[model samples]
Target: MSAQDDVDDVGEFAALLRALKERTDRSYGSLARRLAMNTSTLHRYCAGEAVPVDFAPVERFAALCGATPEERLELHRRWLLAVAARRRPRTASAPEDEPDTAADPPPLPRRPWYRRRRVAVGLAAACALLATLASLSVLPDGRRPAADRAPTAGPLASGTTEAKAPDRSSPSPTPSDSPATEQPSASATPKKKPSPAPSARTTAPPRSGRKPAAVPLTWSANSQAWKLGCGHDYVIAKPPRQVPPPPAPQDAGTWAATQGAVHGGETLVELSVQGRSDTAVVLNALRVRVVGRTAPAPGNAYAMDQGCGGAVTPRSFDVNLDKDRPIAHAVAGSDTGVPIPAVRMPYRVSAEDPEVLLVTARTVTCDCLWYLELDWSSQGRRGTVRIDDAGHPFRTSGIKGLPQYTYDTLARQWTPDS
Candidate 1:
């Protein structure tokens, strides 16, 4: 299907996912781990703000939710319809009772009293009376207005001179002066040189001061933990995914250097704690540092707060290179990347929350990717940190443009890196 079709399918695709999620009754965090993605990202998919790019994730998610094979087929069918609808023209038919404004109305003939015979006769008499009065004004016009005849030869392009209102800028020319005015000389030098072209410093004011609640990234010194304060961004936190599947070890370097650098791509720095299912993993701190510069790595962003209005938002950290960043940073603004300062892991999954290690590696360029390495110092028990799933150091986009040199996971194509 076309790219447009995929975007349009967001709503229906999201609805099905929402229902599937409820059927499983799981938390976003649990599900993300199960799906190998971020809890925040899964929320976006289910909220209709974004659609699943890879059917693999969707299929796996469905199976985890215990969706019957037939039900899964229906999900796929609806997904296809939603995507197809996107490509379909939104033109709607007009109501049968409504008039079609496209057609022109018949022209009306202009008729009035001034065009009638009686009115015409009355007008002629009035003109004759005005002429007689004029001829008699002050004894045949005391100095018979000096022959108002216009001069035929003059500098004026249209030579026949006519009466003109005097210009207010300068005193009216004395009658003795020659009527012809001289045009400027070609020898005269040019006036002020056009101001130099504006510099790059002049940019559309950076989008700021307009903040829809930030993801209340809180750091409680006493607790030594990061907490997501209650806000619209996290109103109803979708349960974490079902028991997570085995990890698919991806090469952070190969993935980031090739795919993460796409001009309009997205990268997610997902987190997975090291612990048992019932253990509550508290995050200490994570930094998105720019250690080196890589060629062609321009500004990009991490997708957040798109639809997180009142409920707990998904925790899947996604980066959309196409979206603008919130702040004015040197490399990429909000799109540049996210800096989840020292935050406490305040969310608890279950009674058996055990510490788990998030596997990660040196992924893509700092400019295009946000590799989050967690700190386990604050946890009651040092939780193992693993970083292989969703929101890894580097993740691909749902949809990507024709890549000049970057890899497009959707297309499974790219201009092989040098």
Candidate 2:
């Protein structure tokens, strides 16, 4: 058979196998054993990777699947048509003296409906005669009419073209070449439903010091815009505070006082303890990336490590920069006599309750005058400061361009709150 014929058969076979598998809960192994075939062979058949041209295996598969008898017969009919579609007859002319050597006889012309009825009637009459002769035990009967006995003649004899035969006592079985009348039986097995397939993605892991499971942050691409929704809003200080080192001890060893200012705006920041913090970070990092797009001019990514040594349980905390924070001192100047305009840092954080926080309103100064003016509320919380340089506002808030800094005890990373 041709290659095209092979593909059609395999396609039909695959359909049959899938249907069977759907109807029966049995796996490939079970079906293979039932068919008395090798598992790999059956697998290839179902996969459409086996023989290219035969429908025999396909019909076998349907039969083993308990497909209805009519379906089986119809399959055979289709197979014949497929074969005929691919068959190409040789067209070379034969030698003049040689007897005709055609592989198949010329197709008979179709008869008109009335003519077909007459021809069928004549055939029935001939069958009657043949049956009668066979029943009589006429032993190699040459006694039959020469018309019926002619070597080249069929059911309609040569000389009897104008006449039809009389009915005989014996009845002949219908020709095997004629179509059958039996309807196929219904399938005996009860129908079954298919099961759902397993998922491919993995689930999130648990975190420390937390009650509920951590919610991992998710991100998706649409067209151009990105939207961020976090557990808490971020703060964007008015004029971002200039980062500075801690002040030196003056009198004896009195610890320096902690002082800082906050902002109220569209941006916000998140600050949390370590061990339990990783969970929230992972869960909401993606949201931060989405909403924190108002980047500083000439933006650059940077990291800061403010060790909260021995003070907090865990040693360090780090920030996940969607892009990066601006260098506060360089951009917003030192927080000495005047509080430079703080850079707006937009961010999102995940927590028990989520809120948006903004940092820095107008200009906030560091204290030598011992007081600076500031508004810190967009962070879902509120705070105010009127300190005029208590010798240094910059000293407390800006270790790394951040308005405030915190130390993570669990993970050793520094986090800045702007």
Candidate 3:
């Protein structure tokens, strides 16, 4: 497979899983039986053909392999990394599907980028929306086709009921074209409903036996968009046609606060954190980027260690720049924050909730200010968010140039309210 396919197919996590399986000294068939999964599926997982969206299979595989606590932890870590890499754009390098012959000359060399151009946003509005248009399939005559029309919902006592009208687009059939038909017999056997699959999140069954209603189709959490209404009885409502939403602003919810003069190239924002009262709030990429005056700093503004110590660095805090994972979700945690990692220094981040960064005033002792030339991206759009100084506090809430930004203490990230 090509490098393109390799990134999606043979990512680091999947590679580790395959190695573990080999070391376990079990055949794919044996592993499948133990895990209660299909042999082909086990093969896929080992081959790195696909990653199971469900982590249950992975955990089971690791357990079967007799993984130790440390090994198991590593597996989980790689799994997360693999999951994240899968989520990210994978056009890092060109694909090399076909190998060149020995007789062929070598390919030309490629140069690395110094200052990079902006990366395009991922699928902006890829939402799952259903558009159920009435699929009318009737005869040209004012009557609907018996065989062609789906079994109608809500059955009556005995005699047949009138079917929905046919498509208006079809030419109407005259009396001469109409076929003689008899009413549906009450004795007609009702087709048996295939049992719902083990993993299905079935919608409520057709209105109890008395009156059969259109089976309200719903997609399972584990299912794809195309696998709609699987394993159901006579599907009353066909799978809904998906309607893609209109394009959203490519750079929605991504900004950086800069300080230096806007000469050319990318924009820059100012950063100033003085005493406890006037210290400017530090925000995540989606919120703002603080730039320095004379010299640049790794994280904070000019001076460095504010109430937070010098040992404390931006990396210490959990950094969440993925636009889709908003700061709001992180704030849902308690204000006290996940306290387990605070002792480690600048911050403590829970593996379960990487977005949640926990830092306390106790950890940061120095009373100082910082200036930073920030760099970060949110959602898909990436750029330095430019905001002019209009005597307004270049704080968490900047002037008009930047959108409404909110800093979440619990999650330790910036959220673009507007």
Q: Candidates' lDDT values, in order?
A: 0.29, 0.25, 0.26
Which ten contiguous residues of candidate 3 have the minimum total lDDT?
A: 222-231
Task: Return the candidate ranking by lDDT, descending.
Answer: 1, 3, 2
lDDT tens readout by residue for model 1, 2-34 = 344445556767888889899876898788777
Least lDDT summed over 10 consecutive residues: which range in candidate 1? Answer: 151-160
Quality of model 3 by C-alpha lDDT: 0.26
Index of the highest-lDDT prediction: 1
TM-score of 2: 0.19
On TM-score, the stronger of 1 and 3 is 3
- Tens-digit lDDT string for candidate 2 (33-87): 6654556556755675533123334555676677786766655444434333222
Q: How many clashing residue pairs are found in candidate 2? A: 62
Error of 3 at 220 (Å): 16
CA deviation > 4 Å runs, candidate 2: 1-6, 52-60, 78-418
* RMSD after CA superposition, every candidate: 35.7, 45.2, 28.2
Candidate 3: deviation at residue 239, Å?
14
* Candidate 1 Cα lDDT to native: 0.29
lDDT of 3 by residue, 251-341 (tens): 0001011111111111112121111112122223322222211111112111101111111112112212222221211122211122222
